[model samples]
Target: DSIRVGDSLTSADRPVSEPISTPPLAPPTLSCLFGANNGPLVGQEGSIVTSSKIRARLISETDNNVTLTVESCIEDAEKTLVFGRGELQLGILIEQMRREGYEIIISPPAVVTNICPDTGKKTEPYEEVVVDVDAEYSGSVIDSLTGARKGVLVEMMDDASDGKTRLLFEIPSRGLLGFHSDIATVTRGTAVVHHCYLDDREYAGALGSKLERGKLVSCELGKATLFALASIAERGTLFVEPGDMVYPGMIIGEYNKVTGGDLEVNPVRAKATTNIRTVLKEEKAYLPPPKRLTVEELIGYMNDDEIIEVTPKSVRLRKVELDSGARERAARVKKKRLQAQMQKKK
Candidate 1:
């Protein structure tokens, strides 16, 4: 219907709007790499291949578990190929797939690597990173990129107005896993970063984990109590408030640097009602705000044995094996492997 210059549509004349607005279709992510979904599939393990641009290859399947290598597509850096893309994407995809009647498990994002046939050397993905930061924070950016992230300085210019500095680096894609949130912290939230794939390069040496100290893991599943948090406050920084929900194996806080190993304590422990005097004594105690890490920061916090569980309702940092016993077993196995390697080096 055509409207005259000043004409207004009445309620009856207007088109009916649905209660929930339809969300726009999502643009493809930078790139996606899927692995570590070792769970049984209900349907014939073949639909995801035909319905979308995702590429999947069945690694193994049995009555109990199905493993697949799923790759996501996106325009490459040169805009020449859609061969690369995901940690958050994978988690969200798996959650959506489950909602859509599929059974799957997916791991966090990781750098995909290939071997150079001629040299028989391992090569990993690299990225072209462009960072714009305040002149004062430029040094921190440069140090972080060039030293910790295995980045090579491409260029640095202070030509921009407003005391801004521009930095360019070619860094391993893996090095960027948790850099987004960290740069902000280092620069006091004064840095702007942009990055994309830059072909595979020679393998960088082993990089260290992001966590400087061990984490505070919740031993019991329940809402966190203030008394419990007060008890744990001296242990390390809490990542949850007094009333937040926590589950077994979920990380609730950081551990003291001096005592560095995952410490399991009950966040959900209730204060005994008989201790009113003690409560009053402890009530005035200052509780530092817990850290609110994003999915990327949580990714940084991950050890090889942990996973960040993301869903529509919540993002929970959890051990890969929820069972405490299983995690300990895995840790012991890892320690033995490390010891054996050290012996070999000796």
Candidate 2:
């Protein structure tokens, strides 16, 4: 007789067959999940708008998907770890979640590491990096990767068609930070980089240093005028145009000259007007457009002492030590500490 769990089954006039038993399905090993953020874009695009809804959807996903598992982590309130194939696979999941109208806070993608219990030693994940780029770009890629202290080039192959080269390296997770932008700039958007996990290994030395230059800061808050930018642009590249919002301590752009110590210029002040007017028409002013930094660029460009402020609508780069006086004080203290450590080693 066929019977449902909740309903009663009655016997018919004809003989009934015995019920058949089935084995339970095993749970899935793979899982895909997302995290939360306080960005303004949340709740704007999807049916599951609330955080709770998002959470529920994730939990419900494991119901029929026997191979997958979902659970919350103990460390962070706003984070969830979804173990899956690799970063590329996880990246696809993140894109889907975002398209569904969920605002998320994604830390730069990293591989989960483990410790060897017997040796009590730390180990990290690594990847095989394959880069194909123009011959000119090969040097910059090598320099950049080596600077990051991430990987070593294993081989190089020449591409005869366009005078390009293919380079391979074994890179650590930390070293790959911000490599995307660097590759784009070096190859002029012609390089192709592919990477996947290789194996666990001992920690590599410190990755390359952060940006060496200081920001072009603004001293006041107001609309930027052409005259103000003209003067400031002489110091370095300008990040703002005339009539743009200016705030004190805001980084306007990067400087072109490396020798000049950190320079800060006010962009809000207007040009002075003259009382006496000439008969000839006033000369027109032309200003160059400023370079805008995206989230990835801001992250890649920031120094260890800085943090990238990410909001739904905007991304701003600010010093970790917000106050100028405080930042100077911290730098001095850090310098003294490093000097003391060096002396101790001697």
Candidate 3:
């Protein structure tokens, strides 16, 4: 309450109210951080992918951008945590960084958890999402939110004349990660989504994993050859084309179904040159162009062992280990560790 410009108010024996100080502006807690992009192609595309350069760049980001903050990891200086408003804001930063010729590896969006001051319990962020979809897509949207995302249905209203529906949901923040792509898929690009911070609540169990099919990883490094890609394409879809540059542990394509799992194939293998010529005409192989992923999509599709290699000239996906044998060994080690943990729990 404030006094009028020309009027003065006086009180006798007034009880003083407790002083309320404005809270200092705190940095946003990172939903995920971009890890080191230390792939084989690290320095080729960007001039600033090193620890020092990345740190400098990230620190500078906070100067102009109010939605995000940067901090170095105590365990590894090469890795930095970038706290931001959400994936969309972070994705824009990644794109800008790449354009500036910085090569980096981005990690999947990490879920942020906090300690509730009052209850002394772990808390996680939640969101209020509102979606408008065509009548035909309304059911699927509801199912995805309530079933897969653990969202609470707040309200649903149908527009009979226009054949569209308005839906509201209170969903865990982590559940909304990568959901824009799914919403596009389900609604045939006819849906609109708006979300804002709701509140923090006790942490929930796992919402679920990305529903993407397994990817095709390359086993060799070189320019892909039509002779080799044609053979590999039969197993599933091809993401790389002939003459495309590929490296060991690079993701080349995706399997047709989720059950197919990951498979390693040679993207650079070429047919042996021989003196013998075929008597009959050979059919020319036609291969589809490789899939191009946006910064958000790339981050969304990446697995734990994978990272997005961002460079000014190129964007690639590669395994952390790089070598096929090393990756397999790492996978085995991880599996054993998980099994041990499970046994301990039991």
Candidate 4:
């Protein structure tokens, strides 16, 4: 196959035009970390996993699992670096890792910012979002996105073929972080959402989290009882139903927005019975359906001080420190540190 029959082989030191600018070596725009409570991954200490678009190095083997980092880098083609790109890919990676008998506490994904070379301004990657929903639900979707997510509406059109409304917008990649479930809730699970990277733009300016509510954590470990769930349901929504296993520091539900701040409660309290008979009959209690979260939704729902515990058998959400006293102390310290930083910025 080598240059047969005097056919001249076109060879050069380099390409004349550099071939489509080589895609400009995509910038690292997203990140996640190990939980603050994890220690050495059992025996896999000092191990690292990397791929074409992501790199996770076991930065520390210390028992206190804090100070973790991520970098999107192109490496071996066979490795999957897709964890930072698509939620489906991320879910797949977690599933695969858990099935391999590897369990770890992973934090929620956060967006990484960069300085725009031209304007010398802080910039973060933007995403082009397309949402198709029933015409009746379009208003709710738009209100949710524009309210606190800082999304800019680009176009709104109605699909002639399906009678659904197509809403397009440009939103910060960070804004899309855990918005899938919210959209589903608003649209009654009739919405289809998709996003793709556009380009970096001037910082959208920090915005309050649309998901600013706190979580309902368990105070004890045991199988949830209907009596305990009834009490929990009164506070807000319940994530676990009767008979589900729960542990201390594990998130059992989202606290009511009105009654904000993380609240610890018992999820396994047994119903009390007495020999005394009351004249009035106790009413039969109907338990509401538990709000089940998929892996992607769980990631979106996790707080910075929280992590998702992955295992082949279960996926659980828990605070960094399993001990309530330690977790509160850590939260206070983090709060104070953040306040100090904010003061310095001011």
Candidate 5:
């Protein structure tokens, strides 16, 4: 008689499937390197801290997810690097770690490109996208994908019976970054999109940024006040609720579509209520629900000079330089560097 031992059965010996084979590791299609979170809230909520702990967690990730690879930076041993198939795949790991009480800071996802030694041509990853949506929304979807993302529709099939359309496009891997949420919104949460690697293509011209609006930065450090949020809500969407902790350089919201500059608001300012006027006389504070950015959304929303601070309890965005004067000075230096590079190219 066969007896159960742990998850398997064995008396003398029971027949079982042969040992599973481990495939050779393949180079990642895309990769993004991330470091430990060193923000103002570091170690406040997360149990896991220190470089050794972060490295151990990342090593476990690569061991389980074969497609992922982890390496240490040659220059900085404290910094850990992760390579993966795509932004979503890597972002999933970060989200999981955060949920498990690990705090880490992530850099913006960068496409892994190659350059030909002889031809001097740059190459980047591409993906074959298959999308299905209602016929009525097809036009808008097509326009959006093709116009801004530089996607080429290879084939379109219309099913009159169901009034649905199927679209196939060969798009750059970079183009698909953060495009998922937009597709859902455009299709009213009904679009079904799938993508797979479609070989690398020659470098294309620079595509525009996904985020067109500027972020709302905090100018003070304290718990957010309802009165302050009410005034800030008119400027753009809020990311924090009343009594939420905020700090200088922390991003509180997005700017209005028409407004171009980054707005610095004091979210902790309190209202001066006169003794004579009752609380009922004050205008009702009705602030819209803050837009809680998901991992993918946060990756798409980040700028070159910004960092995403992740904790066990929350995910927040802030500038690299917290002081306003320092931030502006850094911007000037960046601009100068850009101008110098442009001149060198010329």
Candidate 6:
């Protein structure tokens, strides 16, 4: 009274919800667009546990999340750009993913611009930026936004008597890459910035004005000495103090002066002394405590020629052209190109 046909049973078939004896087959393909796992606190607390566990979760995610489409990219086999919201949203997702166990390397957020084949004009995506901050901080925000080529101010309204103000501007995506930290600092952590993409338009002139200030770089590699830091403290704010390990070209602090210049101050030098037997205890080193930069601050402070090297444990700023000789050559080439452009304009 029963017919056997391959794996299918014929009692004329069973209900859809009823159990079948055969095991399910695996899907043909699965992949993921991984993001960065930066900051010192990542792996210390979370489920999923190891990096491999994170990878497994991502692959499994593809099975359940219907919206994501994964594919291989030639730029780096280990990296994939999950094309979705801007870096901020993607960053939040990456943070959450890392909390769940995946260790991924994320590049700086860049706009994927399009070229008009007909007119050969370069285009970039724009954004609508909304800012809620104290009234006093409005000027700096306006100046910084304008400098970045953010479009006209659409509105400025006062928020309820907490002495807060709300400002809105249509900004280009390129202009907003590192703007969040600057807004926060300027408002003393009281400002909130919300932005979403607008439209793709002509490229903005440049977006580095907000990060134009120069940085204090370490001229040598060693543990920072208190004596040297005390002497160098007058030139600028200190980023590292005594006993902190520093590497050459490492950005230690920001200079106070507006005009850009690199100061060669070695923080690891030891004091020389003669063996005169004086019974006084060693003088307490009076060094100013250094400022520790957060991840947002570090990103906000880097220039176009530099990059923020992030790891699970640390964030380091380095020249995009890492080697000294290569950096110098690149600088020269850039300078020459600028000079030629200026000459052409004249």
Q: Each model's C-alpha lDDT?
A: 0.63, 0.63, 0.79, 0.70, 0.82, 0.62
Residue 242 displacement in candidate 6 (angstroms): 2.6
Would you give me the overall lDDT of model 3?
A: 0.79
User: Clashing residue pairs in candidate 4, if any?
Assistant: none
Residue 210 of model 6 has an lDDT of: 42
Model 4 residue 322 lDDT score: 72
State the lDDT of candidate 1 residue by residue for 165-251, as single tens digits: 999999887787667777988999988888766777789988753446888888887789877888899999888998777778787
- What is the lDDT, from 0 to 100, of the residue 345 in candidate 5? 100
lDDT of 6 by residue, 219-260 (tens): 677788878887788888988778776666666777777767
Least accurate 10 contiguous residues by lDDT in model 6: 24-33
lDDT per residue, candidate 5, 204-261, as tens digits?
Answer: 7688645478889999988999999999999898899998999999999989864386
Extract clashing residue pairs from model 1.
Answer: 31-85, 32-85, 32-86, 33-86
Sorted by lDDT, highest first, which candidate order results? Answer: 5, 3, 4, 1, 2, 6
Structural RMSD, model 6: 9.3
lDDT at 262, model 4: 88
Best by lDDT: 5
Per-residue lDDT value at 241 in model 6: 71
Off by over 4 Å in 5: 1-27, 209-211, 257-259, 273-280, 341-346
The root-mean-square deviation over C-alpha atoms between each candidate and the true structure, in angstroms, is 12.7, 8.6, 6.3, 8.4, 5.0, 9.3
lDDT of 6 at 258: 77
Q: Candidate 3, 228: how far from true, in Å?
A: 1.7
The CA root-mean-square deviation of candidate 1, after full C-alpha superposition on the true structure, stands at: 12.7
**lDDT per residue, candidate 4, 164-259, as tens digits?**
999999988888767898898888899999888788888888776554777899989789998888878888888888888888888888888753
